[model samples]
Target: MRWWRQLSVVLALLCGCATSPGGKPPPEGNGPPPPVPDTLPWTPCGRTAIPLGPAPEESDRGVPEMVDGERALFFVAEAGATGQGVWASRGTRGPGSCLVRVLSPGPTGLGPSEATRVGNRVFFAAEDPEHGRELWVSDGSAGGTRRVKDLWPGKTGSEPQSLLEYNGLLYFAASDPEHGRELWRSDGTDEGTVLVQDLDPGPEGTSPDRMTRGGDGALYFLAHFQGLSTVLMRSDGGPGAVELARVPSEGGILESLTTAGRRLFFVMGHLHDPEMHLMATEGGAPTLVSMFAQVGGMAALGGQLYFSATTGKAGTDAELWRSDGTEKGTQRVKDLRAGEAGSAPGGLTVMGNRLFFAADDGTHGRELWVSDGTESGTHLVMDLEPGAGSASPAELMVAQGNLFFSAEVTGRGREPWVSNGTAEGTVPLDELAPGALSSDPRRFVRAGEDVFFTAADGTGTRKLWALPLRPQGQCGASASWQALRRDVVTSAR
Candidate 1:
């Protein structure tokens, strides 16, 4: 059966009959009822279809990104398939959608790797046929890919990981023959590559990972300098890197770091006990911003920073928290009280004045959730039906006013889903392709009115997919409503 039909059947079983406001029946509908207003405040809408690519037999595909305002690419790791690599797709929507071949290198074949974009080129790390793992670059325009550096050259280089654009150059961590995992940088030019500084240069020294760009004009990263403790470091593309702060010896570790304005914010401690904290760019004491104890994912928008934090110890519920970089003003933005169970929030993005996130509120496996700083107004916009055991949203990206994400709704697997912020506006963008699971749909760049994302064919092949923002006058009502009818009828059948 067409995946869309399967989706509809699943949703119908989950949502039951569609009735008007106040439980009123449709006014004698025969030849298709009047088109619903696509602009419902917070409805979800969009369609999902199979992306074009050589579907693999089995494996996981993910970590998608839009690049150069045109291409969408992602990594495909075939469970046991050798030479696993990254694939690209051009033009997010319509029949012209297809994959563009790129580079892949493993031990004897290409293994799984992560990719990020800088300017017109895409930078990633993959196992080299000779070296362990090396940094490679692609122009996004299909062609031959080249190894930018062999880091270790002759000996053994475990893996050159964490490719990030900072201070006008691409910086990453790689393990050299002499040094464990040290910091390296490239200008995308034959200044070739330079070792910025080794996090743990000694034999017993640990490696530094998770390199993040801070608003203070320096790079902030997490490393285990001594013992098994993880500490945060700041480097200004200089020789002497400064150790900004260390994780408390209370068995806590910092997980992620992000920058907003002049302050650097990060998630501190393990998942079991988490807290959102902030530090100055010039290096100072780390301040605890929230007492919530369980924070996940943080994004800075406008002048305030938003993140997900658990409100209670129920272990099943969480809420969105916002801060103005102040301890006293930190408060919950969404008033979703803990129910009999709780919700797990994931993937957050900022568009204009709103903050978007993903959550599984016990009922909807995992659907799109949004907030605009109003406690009473926060709610679910898209509810992937079937109340199944599998639906879960991966990443959230905002492009041209619409939000895009990946979810596994059809027991078949996870696929790319889109929404316009309304419950009725949510739809799957890649629900047509059989066995196509789209994960990590991110808006890397916007070209004209279109948004591009990386998606994996659940069949195992990972590739890029693009979709245009609803054009003016194209659909009389809001595109959200049009996307609802189109996506629901088509995918849900």
Candidate 2:
């Protein structure tokens, strides 16, 4: 398949719009929208809904990153017809109500950009058709976009991808004219962008691509030094990039990386022979932490690492697992019977004492499930109907003692859904405007008492949305705020 086609397929899965083998629409209506409010509340935070508009074409949008504090949202919006660009949305309510803007390219057309946020600024990379993908930044404030680096300017520069914030500087990976994929940094200034070091160092090698900050002050990533072999590397944002360990070339591919305490943990091996491995940040051999499991998603919460993994003879099912930095100590927390005949863990998040995840028990297609570190406590929070398949939960967040997520419902394509960890607490947020397709809640960042997210409109235009998270029963007795409502108007039409 073409790169654009692959990108579209990924987007369809991420956006919860799976098509049949012959390209027919999936099932419909997980459930009907909540009844309309009889009267508007003086302050209704529970009733707000946000929308994430449609794709530029039928292609896909992928890799959404939420800015801390929920001030903005960033993601790669790609179209087979228009290529790809980095898009930003300015609120949390849903897509229709927030202001949406596309970042400017550095004299060349932009394509396939990824973003990360630090403080009030959002940094990303966009293709400089002439110089390759370069680093850029945008202040969350209105009219604050600017290009940070063109790197090689005219020559084929490394594609600057994967923006990660560490120690007040933004670190990323890009191909340079002289070096393959090397580590680069930006100091929130236009002139500070430069190559930190090349992990590959020799010819025909690629440095680390996805740079993630570890619990220690150092940065950890993966690089392919020789042949098709990939290795793990660490850097302290200085000139030296240290090689930690080489992944087994035969069947090991490091899919994801994270850190807890002073240990660097990652998912290694293939889905067929999966294992979660860990290594000390001081540098040593990686030890297999878990076995015969395919890790789908992971997150760190309260010094423990929480992830979604599947374990079975055929490697067909999935469950939630948590670890306290020990091999024998690691164990399964929740099993949704995923990978059986047909089921899987969709998305995961760690908040307070609970691990929230999405799973399909066959009957509900896919719905939200939460576990409190006990098998008996594992239960479904939302039972989505067919058609509106709630495959995975995206943008899982905690706001004002409540849990919020984005999922597709029976009638809704993909919309924002929130829960208080119970059936009575789960409901769809109503859109602020009528006739808007409120779906794809990118991420929820807290800004004071309000939670913000990136959403799409009916026309498929992306924008930011916000909702004020108020204390329960504070909005008065007659006021019912069960659904999401929008906060911004779109300029598409």
Per-prediction TM-score to the true structure, in the order listed: 0.71, 0.71
In order, the Cα lDDT scores of the candidates are 0.56, 0.57
Each candidate's number of clashing pairs is 40, 51
Residue-wise C-alpha lDDT for candidate 1, range 1-493, written one tens digit per residue? 2422332222223222232111123112212123334563332223433243332212124333333332233333232233454443223222222222433454545454556556555676656556666777755333534677776775355576777877557887777667766777886654658877766657554567778777667777777766657788877776678887776535544447767667777766643454434433435666766565466677887766777777555544576777776777778785454573456566778867877777665555666677787776677765665554535666676665666666676543556666666655566654534653335343334432345444444344444444544444443354444645664644542
After superposition, the stretches of candidate 1 with alpha carbons farther than 4 Å from their true spots are: 1-50, 55-88, 92-105, 108-112, 140-144, 199-206, 248-250, 270-283, 311-317, 339-341, 360-367, 382-394, 406-416, 428-430, 433-493
| C-alpha-based local distance difference test score of model 1 | 0.56
Error of 2 at 52 (Å): 11
Model 2 steric clash total: 51
lDDT of 1 at 376: 66
